[model samples]
Target: MTEESDSPMTDTDSTTTGPLVPEDITADSPFTLPGFFAALAEGRLVAARCTECDTHLLPPRPACYGCGSRAVTLSEQPRTGEVISYTSVNRPPSAFDHLAPITVAVVELDSSARLTGRVDASLEDVTIGDRVELQVRDPETVDIDPDFGLSYEEEWPIHVFELI
Candidate 1:
């Protein structure tokens, strides 16, 4: 009778290999929604522009919303923008309780793309039309994810903005 080993098996199922390691996860496309944001690690604020309608997509999409065109191009935008609107979170959510009194603002990028991000300013300092500059932040420091359905982690970059 042979004593069986409980160790992990290789592709050939020899069982001589130790525990199997997880496969490396990666994005499908460099211009995918997550991929665009991931570039922030390099201090870049990139967006997808529709080739047909010439509309820029902030979160990025495969198809253009204006004309339903499948042709999209990802590009970096001017790093400055004006604050369109904003709100403050005094009673923060579970993931942001440590960062209460956080001010979130919608900024219209110089290229006409609207992106929401946290501003480093007091309540009195923030106002509509105020010029703000993009500042890449360690995602954990910002502790907020503008991308709905995707959680922000320390490894990702947070495209934060500050009044200029």
Candidate 2:
């Protein structure tokens, strides 16, 4: 099998060129969700924690988006979680129509941070209080707005949770 990428073959060129930003993969910050994606690429699940209150932020924010605190740190989280809320989509958005009946959910990790992610389990089997483990799956290509530079456009992975 083969595929084609319209993204810049290399971002070092003097002329900054890019195809339409590809889907939701575009990330613009390390202190934001992209930083969590980067860590997922490294086979780790990390969250932002407030040094002041020890609160965990699932999609990390530089400053504790939770409490208006400037003391935020990326802290790795426990891989296990339980389903808090979820929905099974009969029709996914255009980009993901091929994956209908997808289960998307908000899972509360053991550390008390709730994260929204697609659950990788048989649709019929998903339910509230179901035990799951955070897992990383390769995204094949990571894309981002051209202004941020190519460092953000490498092969990487994102987090998904599997029923345990």
- Identify the runs in model 2 with alpha carbons over 4 angstroms from their true place: 1-34, 141-154
| lDDT score, candidate 2 | 0.63
lDDT of 1 by residue, 33-113 (tens): 456557667766666676667677776555578787756666567778789999898987666666678889999877777
Model 1 C-alpha RMSD to native: 17.6
lDDT of 2 by residue, 77-148 (tens): 677778898888887665556567778889888777778988887678998888877887665432223333
Q: Provide the TM-score for each candidate, comma-separated.
A: 0.73, 0.69
Model 1 residue runs over 4 Å out of place are 1-28, 143-154
User: Cα lDDT of all candidates, in order?
Assistant: 0.65, 0.63
lDDT of 1 at 90: 94
- Candidate number with greatest lDDT: 1
